[model samples]
Target: MAGIVIVGAGECGTRAAFAARDAGYDGAILLIAGEAGLPYDRTKLTKPIVPGEAPFGGLSALRKPICHANQLDAAGITLLAGTPVGKVNSDARQVTLTDGRVFGYDRLLLAVGATARRLACRGGDRALGFRTIDHAQTVFAKARGKVVIAGAGLIGLELAAVLSGQGAEVTLVEAEALPLSRTVPAGLAERLMARHQAEGVRLLCGSEIEKVTPGFVTLSNGKRLPAPSLIAAIGVVPNTTLGAMAGAMIDNGICVDAQMRTSVPGIYAAGDCANVTLPNGQRVRSETWRCAMAQGIVAGQVMAGQTASYDDPNWLWSDQYDLTVQVVGQVADRPDALRQLPEAELQFSIDSDGALIGVAGIGRAAAMTKDIILAQRLIRAGAKVTARALSDPAIDLKSLLRTQGDV
Candidate 1:
C-alpha cells in the first residue's frame, strides 16, 4: 500500500510505527530491523545480575520487543528483521534489501542510529565495545577478574559501577582531565567524582595508555595494570551511510529541519542519526534516548500529514551506584540562577531576553526529576524567574510555570 516505511527498529523507529498509527496513518507500516529477535531496551544492560542467573536476563530488551507481539500484530505493522539493507533508492522511493527484495513507500524515515566509536590505539582491537545486545551479553556474562575500560564517559562510569558492585576490579582510562568534562558542569562533575572514588573506583583521568598486551595494560607513564578483560565505552558515531547515499545533506549527521524532514523530498531522518537545524542554521544532533523517541514521534506525525516539530529541550540522565544525574537543555559553565534544594543542587541558565535556556542537576531522582521537568516547562514558556525565587524551597516551581506568560 506504499505506506510509511521506517528503517531501523530501535526505540526511535519502533515508536514511529505506533505514532503513525495513532496519528491516523492507516497505510501499511514497514519496520526494518538489522538485528534478529525482538528489539531490546539497551538500558537494561547496565543492571547487575544475580549469580547463576542467565546472561539473557540482562538482555531483556533483546528478548522482548519494545511492544508485545500482540500489540504489533494489532497495529498491523510489518516487521522485517535481521535483513541488511543494500541501498536506499531515493529516486525510486524504494528500499532494497541485500537479499534482492524491494519495498516501495509513500514516505520513508531513516532511524538507522549510531554505532560505538572505536579506539585508535595500537591494542584497541583487544577491547570489546559496549553497544549492542550481543556486546552486553559477552561483557556481563562473565564480568569477573580485572577489566580495563577506556573512556570515563557515562557508559564507562556505569559499567564500572556495575562491575565493581559485582566484585570485579575495574580501572577506567580517560584522556580528559576530568570525567564527563564535555557535558557535565564542574560542580556536578566533582560530586560524581567523589562518589565514584568513595565507592572504590580508581580514577586515572588525564592519562593515556601506551599499549595493551594480553591481560595487561601499560600506561604512557610506564605504570602497568592487570586487565584480564577490556571494554571500550568511548562514544558512538552516527550511522550515516544510507542517508548520505540518498543525497541527504550531512554535517555531524543527516541534516533535517525541526519537522524531521531531510533536504530530499519524501525522505526524513530522526533519532541519533538526525541532526536538527536550528533557526540560526546551527546543526545539533542529540544522542539521548528521549531525544530519539521525541524525534521519532515528530517524524511519524509529520509524515502522516499532522503538524508537529521537535521543540522539546534536550534531556538525559545517568545512574551510577546510588547517584542519579540529569541534565536538561544546554547547561553552561556560568548560570544566571542557582538553587540548592534539600536533595539537589540546580544551575539555571537564562538568555539575554530573560528566558530560561538550560538547567542541570545531580541528586536523588525523586527530588530532582519533577523540578527538572518543571524547568523544561519554564524554558518552553519563556518564563522569567529570580535567583531568590529559585533558591527558596517554599516557592513551588510549578508556581513559576503557571505565573509566567509566554514572552
Candidate 2:
C-alpha cells in the first residue's frame, strides 16, 4: 500500500501520524524519527534538569510516553526510529534513507523541525546547544561553576533560571539592547531582566562573544568572563535541507499554505520547519510546541482528504522563576502602539484605530491565566478596548466583551 510518510518523528511528526489515523485514513502510516529514543516532550527537558522539587517529574520518568512506540503500533503506524532520510525524490514520491532503504509515499509530511543556532568563536565546541534531551543532559551534568549563555532569548533565559536555581553562576550575553527585545515589548523584557537579576543571574546586554578559550570568554565590549561551561541559545534554523533538495520552496523556512501544503505536489510541511502564509500574505513560522502540535493536526487532517487550515494567532508561554509569561499575536512590530495596563504585568498593542492586535501578560500563573485567555479572545475578535477598561482589574473581561457586543 502506498503509505503516508512523515519525516522527523518529533512532536509534529508523531502528532501528524496520530491525527491521520484519527481522521480515518486507513492507508499505511510511517513515522520516521531521526533521533534514537522514543518521542518525548522536548520542552520538559530544561525544567527537569535542574533537579529540584516540582509538581512534575522528568518527561521520560512519567509512566506514559509522549508518543509511545506501542501506541503507534496499535494505531498501525510503522515507526522507523534512529533512521535518517538521506534524500527525497519528489517526482517519484520516494525517500532514500541513510541505510539504503527506500520508501514510497502517496503523501508526505515534512516536519523535520529545527536545530539550535551556534555561536561562531574559538573553542566554540566547548559550548553546548540545548535542543535535544542529550544536550540538556550534557549541560546539566556540567552546569556547575561559572556558565555563560550566549543569548537572552526564551531558551537562554529559561536555562539561565534553571542553572541559577541549581547554584550555577549564570551569565547571559545578548546582542540586543534588552532581553527578548525582538519578541516582547521593552517593559516586559525589563521585568524579565529584573526577575533574572533577582535570581542572581548576570545580564550582559548589547554584547557579543568575541573569542572563547578553554577556560574563559572575551566579549566584544572588552570584558573577559569565566566560562567553565557555555551554552548558545541564540535561535534556531529550520531543517529545510531535505525539503529544499526535493525542490520545495524555501524562505525563512519551508514555505507552506494555510493547509500546510508545500510547493511540491503531494508534500506538506508543518511545525518549526514550515513557514505558513497568513491571510494577509505574511509568512510566519512558530517554534513553540503548541504550534507544532496544532500545525501537525491540521496538516494530518488535510492529508487525509479532510479540509483544514491553520489560522490561529501565534501564542507562546515561558515559565521562569515563578512567573508565567504569555504572549499572543505580534509584540515587537508595534512598540509605539503598545499600552501598559494599570497592572504592571499586563500590556496590549493596538492597531491605528485602537483595535486590539496583541496581548502579553507576565505574573503568577494563577493570576494571569484568565486574563491571558480573555486577552486572546479580544485580540482574535479585534475588539476595540479602552485603556481604562483594560487597566482596571475590577472590569471583568467578559463584561467588557459583552459591553462591546462581542460576546
Candidate 3:
C-alpha cells in the first residue's frame, strides 16, 4: 500500500511526521534522513552543546535528539537513517534512494532543508562551514588555534563567543561596515560590538579578503592575516536540488502557497526549504528553529488533510557573548522610522504602516515579550496600534489581550 513519505529528517521532516501521526494518519509513514543518529537541534551545532566547556559534547551525545523519532515510531512511522534520496520521480509518485531502493508514496513532503554555505577561495579544504555536529566537533578540536571567521554574522559571532571563552584568539572579518549589518541596525550592531569586544573578540569590519592561503588569509588591504584555522559562516542556501529535479518551482527556495503546498500536486514543502508569506504580505524563508518546526507541523497537518495555514509572527533568537537577542516579525523596508524604547534595556521597534512590523530585544526577556505582545496586538487588530499606546507605562504584557478585548 502507498504510504506518506518525507525527505530530510531534520527539524521540519521530523516535526511533520510526528504531527501527521498525531492527526491520526493510520497509514504507513516513511521518513528519509541523510544523516546518522536521530534528529537533534541544529542551532546547537555552532554553540557549545553543554554550554560551559570547550570541545563540548556533540549533538549525537545529546540524550533527547530523537524524541520525535520515538513518538513517530510508536505511531508506526518508518524512519530510514543514513539513506538519502537520489532522485524523485514525481510523476510516478516514487523516490529513488542512493542504494537503488525505490519507494512509492501516496503523498510526499519536501523538508530536505539546507546546508552551510562553503567558502569561495583556493584554500577551500581549510575553510569550514557550520551545519552538523561533525562540523562542530572538527572545529572544537582546533578551538585553541588562532581562528579567523569569514563572516561576522550570527553563526560566526556565536562561535567567536564559544572559542574566546575557551581561550582562543578570534578575529572576525566582514565585508560590510558592521557586524550583522545586513539584518540588524547600526545601533544594535554597535551594542553587539561592545559586547564582543568586552569578551576579547576582534572585529575587522568593512574588510575584504583577497584570497585564503595555507595558514593565512590575505586581506584586500594587502595584509596577510595568519591563522591556524578558518571558518565560513557566510550564509546558507536552500536544499532545493531534489525539489528542482522533481520539477517543483524554485526561486532560491521551494515556492509554496499559504497552505505550504508546493507547486506540484501531492507535495508540500516547508522550513528552510520553502518560501512562506507573512500576514503583512511579505515573502520570506526563515532558517530559524522556530520557523522550521512551526512550518513543518503546518505542512504535515495540511498534507494529512487537516487543512491549516502557516502564518505566525516570525521570531528568531541568537546567543552571542552571554547576551540573548530576540527578534520578532519581518523588518519593514523603511529605515528612518525605527524607534527605541530606552537605553537601559536595549529595545527597538520598527513598524509598517503605523503597525508594529519588527521588534528586537537584547539583554532582557521582558523586552522581547513587550515587542511580541505589541506585534500580536497589531496583528489581532488588523490595523496599527498607536505609538502612544505602545509607550504607555501602564500597559501590562501578561494582560495585553485586554487591549484587543478578552481572549
In TM-score terms, which candidate is top?
1
Model 2: lowest-lDDT 10 consecutive positions: 55-64
lDDT per residue as tens, model 3, 172-271: 9998988877666566778888899898889998886678888899987989998778888888899998888888899889988778888899888899
Instruction: Tell me the spans in candidate 1 whose CA falls farther than 4 Å from its real position.
Output: 51-64
Q: Which tens-of-lDDT digit does each residue in 281-357 have in candidate 1?
A: 76679888888899999999998899998887888889987778888887887776777778888888877777787
Task: Give me the overall lDDT of model 3.
Answer: 0.76
Instruction: Tell me the spans in candidate 3 whose CA falls farther than 4 Å from its real position.
Output: 49-69, 277-281, 332-353, 366-383, 398-400
What's model 1's lDDT at 211? 85
Clashes of each: 2, 0, 0
Clashing pairs in 2: none
Full-model lDDT, candidate 1 = 0.84
> What is the C-alpha lDDT profile of model 2 across 157-198, one tens digit per residue?
998887787677899999998998877777788989999999
Q: Which stretches of candidate 2 lie over 4 Å from their true place?
A: 49-64, 332-344, 401-407
Whole-model lDDT values for every prediction: 0.84, 0.84, 0.76
Q: Predictions ranked by TM-score, top down?
A: 1, 2, 3
